[model samples]
Structure formats: C-alpha cells, structure tokens
Target: MDIRPALESDLPELLALESQSFHSDRISRRSFRRWLRHHDRVFLLAVDQGQALGYALVTLRRGTRLARLYSLAVAPQSRGRGVAGALLKAVEQGARDAGALYLRLEVASDNQPAINLYRKLGYQQFGCYEDYYEDHGSALRMEKCIRPYAPGGDSRTLPWLAQTTAFTCGPAALMMAMAGLPGGYRPSPEDEIQLWREATTVFMTSGHGGCHPLGLALAAHRRGFASEAWINIEGPLFLEGVRDENKKRVMRIAHRQFVEQCAAARIPVRHADIDQGQLTERFQAGANILILISTYRLDNMKAPHWVVLSGFDESCLYVHDPDLGDTHPRQAADAQRSALDCQHLPIARDSFNAMSRFGSSRLRAVVIVEAGPGTAPTPAPAT
Candidate 1:
C-alpha cells in the first residue's frame, strides 16, 4: 500500500470509506471538496492496487505553528492491515513539513481500538469533552509534538479561554492577561460580558462594538492594574463601520469618557504605533500586552480583534487568541471548534506585524499592563 496526497478524482472512494467508517458526524461532500482545495489543509489517502484503504485530514491554523487532525477514516475491510498507521504517519510528516510544531485531534472516548492506536503512535490525551459527538459519546483530546522542543525565550504559558460571544474577544483577552498576573482574579463567563460593557465603544453589525485601547486600559486601571495605551489614531475609533449618526455620536461620547477616565487614572497614553522591538522590551520588563489585530488574515474579515501576547522568540510571537470560531470560509455551519487549537498559538514575526494593524487607515492599538502591588511576576518563558 502507498500513501499520497488526495486528489479530486479520489473523492468517490473517500466519501464511500467515510460513509462506511462512521454513522454520524461525517464530513459532507461539500466540505470534502472545499478541504481538498484549501491551501492550509492536508488531505491524505492510502491506496493499494487502486483500492482505497483509508484517509486522514489535517488543518493548519493560520498565523500559528499548530495543526489539527480534523478527521480520519479507514475502510472496514482494511482494518488491522496497517493502512491507518501509514496514513497517520504520512500526515504527521506533512504537518511538520508545513511548519506546524504540534498536531492535535479528538477521538471518541469509547473507541478503544482507535485510542490504542493513537497511544501506540505517541499521541497523549491532554483534555476531554463530556459529550462531543452527535451520538452523545465523549471525546478525548490528544496532542503530539511534531517538532523538537526548543528552550529559552519561548512563549509564556497562559490560560486558554474562548470568548462566548462574537464581540467579546477584547474582554476574553483581558481576562486571560489578568489571570496570568499576580492578582487572583478568576475571570468567569459573567466577567466576560461585564468587561465588554465597560469597554465597548459602539454597535457592530452583528452585536456590540469592539473595545478601544483607552477603554481597555481604563478598565484595567479600575481593576488595580497599571495600564497604558499605544494608539496610532487620535480620535473616535471603530466609527468607520458605523453609519447611523446617532450611534456615531454615542461612540464619540463613549470614547471621550474612556479618554477622561484614563487621564484621571494617570494611565500613560502614547499616540503612536508601538514597534515590535519596543513591544519585546516592555514585555521582557514584565508587561502584558492586549493587542488589536485584523481578522482578515485570520478569518478573512477585516474587523479588529483582540488577543493577549504571552511571549515571543526570535522568529515567532505567541498569543492567546480568545476567538475559537471556525476560520475556514463556508465551514462554520458544519465545523466544531476545539480550544486545543487556540492556546499559545505561534505566529511568524513577519505575519504578526502584517496582521497587527487594522483597516484601510492602518490603525494600530495596544494596551500594556504592568504588574502592580498585587499582580504576580511575569510568566517565565514557556518550554
């Protein structure tokens, strides 16, 4: 048997094996077609004598050195013949070649045969879900480090939490940053909404507006953290998307309020963009960063999103992005997101710089939080 990258011509046998291998939660023909063509996806098929034996699909997360084994299926007749193992090994190499340091997957908790195979192949269970499949079966989350561990100046470990709402990335990011600090601030789902309430500027097309750097700094200040803002734009931000005059007026009013509170709190405001070198210097000095980045490269949307910069290395910057929604186009309706793919994501220095700015005006914004009397020391570089 030989393993090879799947082609569109192999779709029929692939779908046939998919149908025979599982009863539910099967990948649709549309998804299969789309995933086959996606630049970030690796779909491999194993065949012998022109007969399909099995297949595996891996997705490379953009702006991160992480990949996910989204799906795997083997023909019933081909079981115990080592086809699955070959396909798995091939995909692991494929993911590594694509620059992914880690590969993660979800297996049914009761599927002992598959679990044993994964264990034999060196995947360890890191987490689990109570009822993940359509049949109410539990799932065991597993991960394998494809690349050798490099020590020093690596990412700092932080709690990985997904925002419950679409517009709550800022709140979720702030919560993660606060959790890593000295204070014992345990952020809950309730705090997510509360922080959004405190920092939101206006209304978004789908929900409330995104948070401003000044607003976030003020929120951090009120919570006893020393915060500072670095923004390139001078006045009322995120107003470019708002069309209603009344809403724009309200946003300006909210922006003015945040600016006033930041001034009264003595939070330093730098009306200029912060370069990567300066960001690295401040971070090494024990500051936590909540940065705004454009989701265009991440999710094909030009909207601003917030994430916590946990640490950096010579080539990549690690961040805890709060959003866990599907990044693939036309796949959200069928995809189930996992937190395993969102934590301590590694983005190349060049890619991070490109995505860190937002909009046609190229607005840049970031909030730096310094450890105060109650906060903890800066997190040690991750291993």
Candidate 2:
C-alpha cells in the first residue's frame, strides 16, 4: 500500500477504517472533512487500488513546538501489513514540515501493539491519563522528538525526579540539570534529601522552608560545577512573619552560613531581580538558571517552588518543572497530549514574572548553573 495525503473523497473510507479500529471513540466524517481542509493539520491515508487501509490525523499549534497525533486507525484486514506504520511515518514528516519539534499521541493503556509500534519508532512515554476513553480505559501519552531534545546530553531527554517531600523542589530541579549535563549525574533519594539539607532555609511560612539562591548555588558548586546567583531579597529571606524569636534566629544563622560560603567561593551575587534581558544574556553565555518561583500564579495557592528554566526566547520560557502538579497551563490541549506539558512547560514571560514572587516581600531568587567549559550551548528551538 502507498501512503499519501487524504483527500475529501477519502472521508467515507477514513470513517469506515476509524470505526473498525475504535469500538467507542471514532472520528466522524464531518470532523475528518474539516481537518482535511484546515491548515497546520494533516490527514493521511494508506491505500492500494483506491481502497484506503488506514489514516492518521495530526494538529499543530503556532508558538509551540509540539504536534498532536489526534487520531490514527487501521482497518482490521490491513493489520500486520505495515499500513499503520507507513501512515504514522507520513504524519511525522508532515508535522516536522509544519515546524513541529515533537509529535505526541495518547494511546489506550491496553493497546500493547500500538505502544510497541510507537516505541519502535523512538517515541518516549512522557505522560499518562486515567479513564481517558468513553469506555473509561486509561491511556499512555508518548512523544517523539522531531528535533534534538537538547543541545547536548544523552539524547535531549532530561531525567525527571519527583520530589519525595513537599520541600525538595530545589533538589529535584538541580538533579534534573545535573542529569542533562555531560557527566550524566544520577541523583539518588539520599542525595535529594542531602541537597535540601544543604540548600533550604529550614523554616518559612510553615513546614520546611524552600531553598535560597546562594545555598542552592553553593550546593552545585560543591559538586564540581560553577554557580552565580541573583536574588531580590537581602538580610535573611523567607522570614517575613515569624512571631517566634527562636525560629527567626535559626533562619538567620542558616542564612549567614550560606552567605559566608558564597563569599568564600566568590559566587557572584546580584541583590536584585535579574532583568529578562540579563537572563537571556546568561543563557546564551552557557548557563542554566534555577528559578525559585511562587506557585500562586500557577496553582492559585501561594507557595515557593523551584524549576530549571532551561530555555528562553523573547516571548517564552521553557522549563522542566519538577513539581509537575503545581504548574499551570501555558495552553490547554486534549487530555492525551496534555501529559507532555508538565515535562517541558512553556510560559509567557509577562505571566511568569507575576507568579515568580513570594510572600508580601515579593521576593525573587535565581541560581545559575554555568555550563562547563567546552560544553555546547542550548540552541533556541523554532516554535
């Protein structure tokens, strides 16, 4: 069978094949016709002698490097004949031609054959969904990097570590950055806790407090890397409202040690919020920034969380958010494709600043992890 773009005339056969492959969630002919006529979308069919065997539908959004594989179906008679594979290949090419850097799809968890095929094509499982279909079947969301995932590393996929405790965002974010570096640092749970112990303020509003920029940068520096820091708050951060004198004293002592370490190591400290322009300059100069941000802009409840702001452009910031659940939607897509959003999130610059502060102090802190000498710089991807 040959693969080619589907025409309006192919809708009836496309709907038929879709119905054959799906028991409950099949695309209608009307929807297929509309998608066929739309720009930034692709509908392709595998056919022989004018009879369609399979079809795929994909969607592309401007300003996002992601392409969604909304639908893919093959007729039962065409199973095991490579029809679905050919159609998928065509969809990938079409997506890349449309400037998509990633192709993402949601497949039913029970669909082992489809999962196997996708894995065979180098699609990595990045997300999941429960009760995703009309029949309440769960789904696995997968993505293929149409472009290299990062400028340098073991194939652009950053190793993600979920925070074991509420206050390990700093550790988790640093761990991800380490994993992406050339050394392939594999961080363990023990290291996670240790990093927090080394970096955190010990007390904030409640529970264990978040990390300080100097503390986090010092932690990275101790691990054979260089560090620079920019922070808005001075004279003991995260101590806005502690009625107890003892707790305030404890926070101050810890802050003093972190500051002392920075002074000894000569870690550059900027006692102000780094301008967006300066951030761009540092990124281009080959350093990854770890941002301490307020979750209120994302989750509506105010709390500090940490993330690696790995990439940026004039319009957007691309981050590997460690607290996946706390991140807000930069944009919403269907449930299947939504899984990829947490792994690598894109946020508007203006919206990010509004959320990057904490407490009544409006405190903002950043720690820079400088790329090692001779390490490749991250190139901005086309969105």
Clashes of 2: 0
Off by over 4 Å in 2: 1-105, 108-157, 326-339, 372-383
Question: Tens-digit lDDT track for model 2 on 328-355?
Answer: 3432223222435545555556767776
- The true-versus-predicted C-alpha distance at residue 178 of model 1, in Å, is 1.4
Clash pairs (backbone) in predicted model 2: none
Per-residue CA lDDT of model 1 for 1-383, tens digit only, reads 98989999999998999999999999889989888888997889999999999999999997678889999999999998998888889999999999887789999999999999999999999789887889999999998878875424434446778888778899999988777777777899898888988998867545568888887888888788888999998988877787888988988898899888888888899999899888877777667889999988776868899998877777677788887785334546534457767766778788888999988778899999876765567646433
C-alpha displacement of 45 in model 2, angstroms? 26
Off by over 4 Å in 1: 109-125, 135-137, 147-157, 204-207, 243-246, 281-286, 326-331, 381-383
lDDT of each: 0.83, 0.75
